[model samples]
Target: MIINGVSVGPYQLGWRLQELEEKISISGFVEEELDKHYTITTNTLKFWVEKEQGEITQITVFGEYEGKFLGKIGVGNRLSDLNDLDIKWIKEDYVYKLPDYPGICFELEDIDDWDELLAPIEFISIYCS
Candidate 1:
């Protein structure tokens, strides 16, 4: 999977909900709605999409996703793996973000142990900066 600030794999931020549905259909993936977001599930990946006015505003990847963000960071990577970057924690969401990189954030398995080197990432969220 190729991930950038604006996109995850082929799913780009700001894509229309209909466009995403078409791609999901072509890939034979299943989609489900939960609360305010929609989830797309494939055999090895699960991602959530939140939209506004029919356009995707955020894309969050979790649950067995095997791809890396920017081919470097990923769900299983430890918190220490990001030590070289300027990472900030968002208390309200229990997620971390890099000040230099907009539109992306990471959720760890244990937010309380966020400073622990072994804390593993649980989710990767991409959105509009």
Candidate 2:
């Protein structure tokens, strides 16, 4: 089957919708990226993210399938799957909402890695605020 993303296509939205295993997960290829992203409704691009300030990264979730709830989990599933299940966003404050077509994305923040741990600790604190 073909795969489609906010960026990738072929299957586009239709094929992606089929990947839903009653659950779906969005994981970052790198630790510095937004680790978690999920939607509460169809056509809803808003997603909640797991943020890392220090050496940590990503805000993620694991969703499961339930016929009645029509909910989707992140565990044991891939971002490429969506057909069999509806996105069930875990309720949170940092809900990621997309403002543009395809979706609103983040501009990765730049940082300098220091040999000392203090730099990371201080950086994480700033984000926590």
Candidate 3:
């Protein structure tokens, strides 16, 4: 998905906060000082800004962009939703990590106490180190 004209991907690693603001218009952010980070939340996505080097390191898409979510998966989609993608996923409990795609992770939320049923996606995180 595209955030402020820059797509949410590894290429966003070196993007400055102002540059992003220029593109998406920074309304406000929850400032985090420990690591010079900031979280900008929009109606559709959450941007995690890392300022150690004055750049954005990660982005979490909360819902569909335009008409697709991660190429078909949406916020409430379950693990089975990813069946169409030709990705080899590594599962650890409810979290799925893609080995082929660095800085990308999908987490499922266990709404019920039972873990037998498929869980809906809580969030999708894309990072750049």
- TM-score, per-candidate, Cα-based: 0.73, 0.17, 0.71
Using lDDT as the measure, what is the rank order of every candidate, best first?
1, 3, 2
User: Worst lDDT window (10 residues) for model 1?
Assistant: 84-93
Write candidate 1's Cα lDDT for 1-129 as tens digits: 635467888888777767887877856778788787787776644556674456677777877777787577887887677765545444335677766667788877866745656778887888778
Estimate every model's Cα lDDT from 0 to 1: 0.71, 0.22, 0.62
| Candidate 1 stretches greater than 4 Å from native | 2-4, 26-52, 84-93, 111-115
Quality of model 2 by C-alpha lDDT: 0.22
The collision pairs in model 3 are: none
Local accuracy of candidate 3 as per-residue lDDT tens digits, 1-129? 523224563336457877776766644544445456887676666777775776777777665533234456556766666664665678867667767656677777768664522677777766763
Specify the highest-TM-score model's number. 1
Candidate 2 segments whose C-alpha is farther than 4 A from its true place: 1-7, 16-98, 102-104, 107-110, 113-129
Mark the 10 consecutive residues where model 2 has the least summed lDDT.
120-129
lDDT of 2 by residue, 1-129 (tens): 111122111112222222431223342122123434322221212123232312211212222211111133222332223223443222123222222212211111123663221111110000111
Instruction: Tell me how many clashing residue pairs each candidate has.
Output: 0, 19, 0
Give the Å error, residue 41, model 1: 5.1
